[model samples]
Target: MEEKKFQPYIPADKVVPEFTVFSVILGALLAVLFGGANAYLGLRVGMTVSASIPAAVISMGVIRFIFKRDSILENNMVQTIGSAGESLAAGAIFTMPALFMWAAEGLCDVPSMVEIGLIALCGGVLGIMMMIPLRSALIVKEHGTLGYPEGKACAEVLMAGEEGGAKASTVFWGLGIAAIYKFVADGLKLFPSEVDYTIDAYKGSGFGVDVLPALAGVGYICGPRISSYMFAGSTIAWFVLMPMIALFGSDLVIYPATMSVAELWADGGTWNLWSKFIRYIGAGALAAGGIISLIKSLPMIVRTFVAAFKDYGKGSAGVLRTEQDISMKVVLVVCLAIAVFMWLFPSIPVSFIGALIVLIFGFFFATVSSRMVGLIGSSNNPVSGMAIATLLIATIILKATGSTGASGMVGAIAIGSVICIIAAIAGDTSQDLKTGFLLGATPKKQQYGELIGVCVSAVAIGAILYLLNAAWGFGSEELGAPQAMMMKMVIEGVMGGEMPWALVFTGVFIAVAIEILGLPVLPVAIGIYLPIHLNAGIMLGGLVRLFVEKRKYASEKEKNDSIQSGILYTSGMIAGEGVVGILLAVFAVLNINTDISGIISLGNIGGLAFFAVLLASIIFFCNKGKKAAKN
Candidate 1:
């Protein structure tokens, strides 16, 4: 018996305005906006938010309210394009900033903007092209099985376009509120965005939260389970490990720390301890988590790849519009062309061997990336861990081939960067395609939209990277760039650079213990890697979600509607804060001091008050959803 076909919201016979100039222009603007914003967030906190839903909501608000247009396809196109910026930025930030860090130490020249653009472009294009062949298998064939949470949520958002700004109000309110909050805390210097208190009784310990709106937004989006795991990791690091070090190694000078534990604690407190010691431990755990995740994903990755090829050309161009994809032959040729380009591109540092590695590893990981996002979501996909795994092997391979010193390290990072972008883009592309599939969008057009986004974002990202570095050095307090730092250390470690090995190994064992205990390693590892304050903020957000969920609902529909509203609201908060963050970076680069706090400074108490109001807003919108559901 034949399986019943899955019908989409827009039927194949239906036609609407899509791929319009307006959509392209809007998408381009959003691509730059979200791309730069995510880059800022990634550099600052070593975390980022997805742009798909935000883009969708904003597009809908404009199309339905501003322009009086009612085309869902056009709105979908905007998000498809806009979201690409975020994915590519994620990949680049995870690896490319290492070059900037290395240059700061005079290990090599600062990566030229052209060099940055070329690398990013190569990765972005390759990620899209590599994942194109898998759309049918991963998206259509595996439909109900995959779920693609964010994609489905995005589709629902587009579906809600008929209701106009009624739904978009949550997003708008969130955007406006968060932007004001960020400007007040960071710009006006009314208060510090990050608030902390040292625990006197618990020496070498502290409790704090970055009072910025985005961290709470992230917690709401990521939810309590993952947030709790991260909080747990941070808890152990700040409360358990730091005090232990202070107690046992009080008089001893650690290898990485020039001063004794007591002196370091006195000098910069627990923060100083974290910078010198906890970072390496976190790096090890992050590396271990990436490998564990990849190892666990191996069978599914292989299955996804095989299934993709087995159904490669099915339902593509020759079939219904809803099923149409770029021609397989075209996808193959473009992929090959990109490979050749990588080899010939001097700035990229890839040889013929390097190009082959790019194609092989690029597609392999792209496959893993797509499948992993399908089962889970893009947020949980550990592209950094994969990059670490790639760098370790790529570095050794490059070293064995006599590419040593600065040249070899650069070459290895180049390889890792492309693969990292490929994985990131692949996951993002899969999500976008899943949304398209559900909404009856043309795969070919969505693919083109993604390409446009990548190209535009690839160009803009270079400038953003340069601007941020000029404002605050990569490893500075303002821009920690943890993933990039990890990438740098991994490459340097392979190349015999100075490092504290014991601490790193201890982190590796910690990750192993986490896995043995059947807990998720990556988030826990990330928690350990980050400052406790940031984790605490995220925990607070998670607590709000817990509150929303714990309440008795009139019905499941009311509950879901309420939760959805909070998600949209928080999504806006992340983007709003991120945009302001990049703006502040721009101000810093221009030597324009935006701080007026000297006159109107709000202390920690005020910052706490603002954060409370921000969380309350999420609940308010959630309650609005309950009302909407009742209606």
Candidate 2:
């Protein structure tokens, strides 16, 4: 006889109190809180923590310990709905801030709240709808092969809590430590979170790192391969490309750059060169990688749709809980309606062509995102990379068709915003579905919860974006909005009529070469795009993970257990800093200064010391996890 498949913790026929009134209300509130926190964090650092596990932990504490509720499904529903906030915020922050930056430059009027709200809402809804069809194919069909690490870990947390055997203290400890650290570093300005050093011998070359908890957490979750790829990109740009440009262009006045290289260097430093040229190469590489990735997945896409349609035709009524999804008819109709609205929306610049792009690219990235997170987890998903690709293609098409200047840029950003959110939400939804699958909750109910979360989070995200821009303008040193900067640069380059096509094409060819060598191009290209400092921080996290992995374990189970615990701690750390980051932004907006005169302020030295301390703490946590596994 063939071996049996693993069964869910709860049987399909069993009824549970899920999607209850209390669950919806609590989930909505958490969604708003987490969404706002993520918005603040993303703007400050171009990243957002995964809210699922953190939200699940908090929900369990409140529902089980405080409220005396006993339903695991109810707790699951809360997290499903609440985590949408982070995903939606990530997508919006990556693209929407460009509008605000352009407005500050007098390129166009600031996008109104209604416009922002609609774009995010539509994207979120579309993402959920798009994932509905893929649910059966990816989540159910490939269940064993694709572990969906975060989703499975979340289910484990929920189950352990229900059995009164969960360990949440690690998460709590990380949260407390990170929050206080961020407040001291960022709020009070005790020392810079980012530390840097310029190499006198290498003219334009320099080295630096952001010693923030979230970046480290992201690095650890991404593991060595992806992190290494990113770091490699950074090394190429900072070490090789920067020096080459400084040497060759020292006497030349590059186009789109008004000053000669030597003059620009004396005035603005190496960053001037990176921004004007290196980032174009990075964008080109990222765009090429995205297109290549999309092309490679086309077979999988065709297979998924075929399987989805066949499954839908068989009917889902009274089906097993693990297999059911939102009706295919409803998903199709809703997607169509949203596409129509995008075309008709006055503020959205694209006409029918824009709507078509949204539908096509939105679904394409959504498919890639869901599958990717299944393999790598949400923290590692390259949503911005995909957005970079979309913005490039959209801007090029618009500019070619005579939609130049501010209008073309807005249109490109709008299309990119939708696709970005769609990918983010789709990834989040798939993760939730995986959690539900393992826990034996209703897929349809989880799908509905995702929709509710998206709607509420969309409103909160629009408000938060506007507030952050008002407090400290995007593109300001205060809030770099790095991803938004990249998007804006692409639009300006394409439509503003002075794009550095040579640099961009160089990047594209470089990515092509990398792909031809059978290497992943997106992460490497992104490393090229982002500042070396950020990649250094991420690499440090990856190194820590490598250290943990190098140690011997009694068994694979023990190894997995140790890594899981480390993940939990890091997840908490990311959340802690994010919450504190938001509060700091609020203070800035309220005109409240938080400088403490007597506290230590050793500048870069202080940053290095703090970074060492943070690294030590990570080692401690990893070692503790190993010990716990042995026990």
Candidate 3:
């Protein structure tokens, strides 16, 4: 945090191997793998975790221990590329799935592989390019001024490269165990992936846990506070809200549901009620949360804008190898070319006006995103709000210009997808640049690494989207795709005005009330949006973190190390489970049989017991290295 008179781990005057073929290839693989994995995770849970730390640990494990290399910059390069995939995946999943969801309802045709790829590529490239001009302004000049917490943590992780094996091994262990666990529970149907219990006495109440590795992993990574907030939100949805709805509207037919509430409860139990009404409230809460964050960030966003233009491109003039960046001229030319291509390209589906909207709004949002993440990390960047805002504006503009109906909706989604990706990728780019600045990595090489990641992930994200859509389909319970659903709702509401306003406004007011009460609105809003079972899984992880952190330790360093190890392990679990989930999706697509496992497997009780073990293992591993650290 002490930025003045700063000295990087690798001094600018000294250079080591970086941007090599080995780094690019390794990083590219991580990018695609994490992209696919996170795409699965996000679509399922309405959230995604950054791949930076996991990529760093894995890079160090392979580069330092396995390959017997000593270059920290090479590891930096690997994460730079690897993490790009995650950021891009985050962007793509948040909005692109709206297209597919709309298609499901017959409002639009399914988006093509080429179309998704083009939008991803253009958005990703623009994000990285936009941040190029702001590197000097945000990362270098305003180092301590903006915490860039994730970036700083990544740097610290890299600086501890000697401990890479233990850390990386924790990740590998989580990955392996989670892969098997996910396969057993979901793939083979050894037990249900989710276990739910309806309280018979409480007519409309139900509770459950997903019992999947990734949800637990997400909970641990987010820690106790945020996780608890999420759980609480889910509680309100499942317990308070659902019961209230049923109690009042038992005989009445809801606006969205064709049947009476009593019929719905009798049919699918409380879940039917949730699917019909609670989700809309959750969506409303989520939109309000996003807008609140954006509103709170407005003054600072303005300052970030003014400060960026004043000091723009100052870092591009350095002759030092580490200080050099992609030439601004080349970046501009390429950005213009991408804009032109998007407008002129047949597969991308953006009209000239849509293209202009993407170009103008994309760059503006990219600028906002880069600096916003510097102030608040990527997790709290209010991207959904940005997407919602863009959709609202773009849809209105399209409607006014005679671009109505399905075609206009498709165009609007295309525009939103690019902007969302750009904003996300830009935030990620800034974070990676910050990491590089601290490590004295060559900005130019890191920029190239980011671009490499974008190119590969761009092509790969489309396939992943297609595969998931083909399997469970978006908006289905198996793959909720929450943010996309919200975007879809907004678009429909605007283009057609058919949104259930009463339910949506209920959620909106709920968010406002929660915000006024001084709680973090977004996490709670997300909890409201998702099912109780999923949030319960995450809550259990949070409780584990609380138990671990609250316990006595031999020393502060030991506690920190143990917590760090738990995080690394959890990151691995999330990725591992996600990869296997995709594999299962393949199975589902092919109609592969898993009845054999069900024949031999235990029922829900076995699942509860295994989940208990899973929880205990997290506590054990969180305390695993404490004695070693002390010794």
RMSD of 2: 3.6
Score candidate 3 by lDDT.
Answer: 0.80
Top candidate (TM-score): 2
lDDT of 3 at 282: 79
lDDT of 2 at 363: 86
Residue pairs with clashing backbones, model 2:
none
Model 1, range 501-605, lDDT digits (tens) per residue? 788788999999999999988778878877888889988988999999999999999999999889877766765765566667556545689889878877889
TM-scores, one per candidate:
0.84, 0.87, 0.78
Clashes (N, CA, C under 3 Å) per candidate: 0, 0, 0
The stretch of ten residues in a row with the least summed lDDT in candidate 2 is 1-10
Segments in model 1 whose C-alpha atoms lie over 4 Å from true places? 1-13, 32-66, 93-113, 132-162, 252-259, 315-333, 356-389, 434-440, 460-490, 578-592, 627-631
- Model 1: lDDT to the true structure: 0.82
Per-model lDDT: 0.82, 0.82, 0.80
What TM-score does candidate 2 reach?
A: 0.87
- In candidate 3 the C-alpha lDDT for residue 537 amounts to 90
Compute the lDDT of residue 158 as modeled in candidate 3: 72
